[model samples]
Target: MRFRDGQWLVAEGVRIEYAEEVYRITPTPSGKGISLLCPTRKVMSRGDTLNLGTLSIDIEAAFDGVISVETTHWQGAIRRGPDFDLFPAGRPDVDAKITKTEAGTTVSAGGLSATVSGKPHEFDVSFHPTAGGKPLTTLLNRSVGLAYTPAPSSPMQLADTRIFKHYLFTQTTLSVGESIHGLGERFGPFNKVGQKVDLWNSDGGTSSDQAYKNISFWMSSRGYGVFIDTPERVELEIGSERCCRVQTSVEGQRLRWYLIYGPTPRDVLRRYSVLTGAPGRVPSWSFGLWLSTSFTTSYDEETVNTFLSGMKARDIPVEVFHFDCFWLKAFQWCDFEFDKDMFPDPQGQITRLKADGVVKKVCVWTNPYLGQASPVFAEAAAKGYLLKRKNGDVFQWDLWQTGMGIVDFTNPAACAWFVSCLERLFDTGVDCIKTDFGERIPSEDVQWFDSSVDPKRMHNYYTFVYNKLVYETLQKRYGTDEAVLFARSATAGSQRFPLTWGGDCESTPEAMAESLRGGLSLGLSGFAFWSVDIGGFEGYPPPWIYKRWVAFGLLCSHSRLHGSNSYRVPWTVDDDDQSDEGCSATLRKWTHLKARLMPYLFSQAQACVGAGLPLSLRAMCIEFPDDPTAWSLDRQFMLGDSLLVAPVFEEDGTVQFYLPEGSWTNFFTHEVKNGPGWFTETHKFGTLPLYVRPNTLLVLGKEGEKRTVYDYASDVEVRSYYAREGASAILVDNQGNKLGKLEVKNGEVVGSEVLTGEFRITVVNA
Candidate 1:
């Protein structure tokens, strides 16, 4: 994807043509946009324009504070399918005006404007805030171009026969102190400068450059965001190629992108969700702990019951019990049938688990692949429900299973059939489904049921349709605000699904930090809910690591205990010691602590659903955009808007975190500290660095409330910390319905009518 060798010379066999001059500018009929004719070279005369290529650039106002720029080299190429589902809810109207003066042409819309320079032989477009300040970014001369890259393995000796792939590229200026963040669940450095990121979904675990979710949107620390509008392959050189600009390139005839201007970083996220879709509403029960039967481990009906029973005896309530891939027989993943030999009766077992109150919900794992060993594969292949090759044969691969064919969700019959399969599971008392492994979809030599979509474009977009089908099915079965998904893969608009988890990771402190980085990055990308494997998913975590991860996982939006080859049950991992710092004890402590936080957590979640903000594990930069140090700190995150959590990443529990200018009170201990500084502290396994920010009112649930789903407005304790005028807290019930608000009015805390049922008011650091 890099075409230059240190900026002085182009890479071998690469030809580049820069857009040198703006020949003409014409306003569109809609009066909301302008198009520019840009030639590849300076047109000295009419003869200089002969035998040359011209680039057409269109700038349109999308909505408030958003404008799109599309550059095209060939305007006659056939437009393809599988485009992103932008503005899925509806498009908002904008107030736009196009004016031309002697100086130049400027199109202003929604407080943001794009101005085109009128100087001859100078191709310059600058985006600025309408309130009059420095430009956000500028596309200067030599910034827009097209390149011809030689095909792989082209012989150097046969220059006449070499083939080339064409691409359209644009580079936008980057300021000196601007930092870039978000590229869909990136596990690398949070600041993406000096990194070349390819937005392709892959299954490479948390330790590598491969990402399961690759969203083509990023926010700049300078308070603007850019969303590349393509599901096809996109390569971004964030200050890596030119060191002064962010270069974005895509193969094919045209490249379109939108620049969203937000006076604040949080406003940028809100506008992003308007273009894509807002995150779906999640159920309150999902905030509780989820226990999974590890993959490839020995698990039958008895084994599941024993794990549940041990947790119950240890006072660690498992809200949702998950059965991993072995629920179905080997090599028959999408069969959707329980192994009769292992379980004997799945419905009866699921009924007993729920009826006996051992677990409140049951989740089973499934994928979009149907192996040939299962009889259902033949039915699907015969009925044209599976993806086909160019020659009308089913596309089969042996990566995860033998002769596995992907289910074509693009086909309506296939989607209906998959719904029937899920309906059968719902009949068996299963409440949730873990939609896993949609990242490895084949994109070459494949023909989808919908023939209009390009195969290469469907590579990263496959996860969106797959997860959307399953999530909609769940929504139809369970009413509004009740559907949830533990999905593994995602793209731009996949945030419409309720929940997703971090993919495979190792059992080490480094992996834990990587999970945090990925979650924070994804949160920046507009995903509202995220989870991770408690003790890691690859190896058996030691007791200390397990206990440390338990404290961190319980604080996520959703928490799950899972592993690869070993069980994540507390007793199975910890020694027989029953002290307060043991694995079981630590798990019990955090589980109950989270239960006590349900009142505040559910309200935060409800707010996020409406505003398109992350409810849990929010990056520090989003909360404190003016603080320079907050943009680079990734080790800690804000649980909601009020509480800050720094996960202990060391074996000795030594941790360091930053706090903005405010008064912070320790949540575990009542000690108060004044900060706009960094602090380091050490503790045992029972606690980590958790603090409450200033000017906040925390509505806490009862101390001994064990269940996550209960009447949150009843029997709650209201804690006011440094309460200031105009400060308030919104309250909601278990079903995410607004109850009332506790507002600080005239220096007095007054509650609305709905804050009923024996509430106690406690003051902290007042």
Candidate 2:
């Protein structure tokens, strides 16, 4: 954390010792082996043996182009732990080379270099553009420090003994113009320069700085990413403390971080996806609009039917129907059995719903919690499948429900028990699992099935194993491309599970903007696909808020309409517009608009999987990194490299956004604008600022398609907006099956690649 109060003085009781001298360096392999000694004080005489605060550091390479820097104070301290699922390169052949000279040693791979100094007395790693470059740019900047503060001076501890905690920290330098971003799905601000982020997942709502998903990976504008490899609590100050360095501290003797070198932000993301895992391809139909049964609201099969029928009556295409927690009885949550009172013929009703004119997928809510009243709770507890206290009792608490016990995902049999529960729902026509509530995992005196891992270490990491078990079950039953989870909590590699949503936002415009900020922050953190409750998640959204959010929701990678305690259906919550059918009509329009754009959106999803790009959804900086103005633009985002979507975030409908150096054409209107400047405009709830990039051919589905799951090539149209003479685009359908390539060459069109579908070209006046 922060040691100094402001700039000059250290806090009263805080004791800090920084690495003062580099003792020696023992060098080994090309990219793998190295060690250094960093003393807390200069070694002038042998009297220094009394208090040796010397830190031992091990530097090595992982995978192809990644570095692991581990610093330790007490080598034998017992607190080691649960790390994220990192995929290291299995000794691949590359151009990486490490050599030692008279002064020090150097390691170079691809276009990156890290230099280590021996005689210069520095335990730091200095990174630069080239091995011989004089302009020493960004590098890991801090000395390994040992910190101790007397455990709070309360009366409870005054009588017993003196106490202190051992902490270690490291800070990395930020270049002059560097802007720090990403630590997880944060809501406060996009540029994390002035933020103090804690990498601990919480159940806090989206309206605050507290995040449901807290990832330890942060990427900088200087084009490198750092991952703090700890599942326990980690605090980072991104320029808030020092105003220059990104300082990191964890509550243990050991400190480990992964330093990723990317010359570009995109390159850094690709490298990050390789280190963690890439997200799988979500099924084609999942790109459509989804509607959910609001939590704590009264609902059953009849309620679901009415919601679906209302959508059909208004011609709003809904692809997935979700059942929230009350789908099971109140206190019997996570029993994996549907409430028979509300849904007597669960399987039959689901079958009928799927048999409708529009194909629909069913998603049911699930958590790792087992209430004591649940029929399966005793079975799970008896089988040693629940988290236990140090005294061998099941760790039960009265939090969300009575005597709730967390499923011990560390045990294979426990996971198997959870998987069987999910399989029962899958047998009843359930297609996706809304994996919720993994942020409240216990870190106290608890025991795990795999006793080797400390419970403290599994606090944030518990979500990974929990989500993976359910996701693997989905992948096993359905194919790889068909599995999806609307997960709310995640770690670094949790992006491997597709489609996480922003959690518990209120029904207001500010909350909507906060969700956008969280989603963009998550994108920067390497989450592949993200969704938000269309009308916010907490209360009754105003009609205009719902309609405006509808445009933004439909255009995202995944869209859903959900709320906290009220129905999010258009007609039900439109109090201000009761005199008209405006909400229903607007929902119908935006819902079908997403269906028509399925050809373009699904192709982008395929690119996320096939290429290193995990989420085609991007922050503006990801696309326009060279533009200095784009790094700070968080309100607007590039929707899959082509369309720039700036969702109107206020009730007054006023909009102000930037277009970074492009010829942008309005998607709804044919108006074109020259960018590299700011624009202010006002519009009603029916529209938003969805601008298509210049010179790109939009591969679109046929107009008025009832469902989104059709063969994208059947009646596709490649529409061009201000087509440049040499600009071309590859056209693909919802399944990413190549239809053809459209090019404007030599002032004339040429070539045909479409095999079975009817293809046509239309030009829109820009």
**Model number with the top TM-score:** 1
lDDT per residue (tens digit) for residues 387-446 in model 2: 999999999999998999999988888887788888889999999999999998889889
Candidate 2 versus the native: TM-score? Answer: 0.94
Candidate 2: 10-residue stretch with minimal lDDT: 134-143
Q: For residues 266-292, could you state the per-residue lDDT of candidate 1 as single tens digits?
A: 899999999999999999999999999
The whole-model C-alpha lDDT of candidate 1 against the native structure comes to: 0.91
Which residue ranges in model 1 land beyond 4 Å of their true spot? 151-162
Best by lDDT: 1
TM-score versus the correct structure, for each prediction: 0.98, 0.94
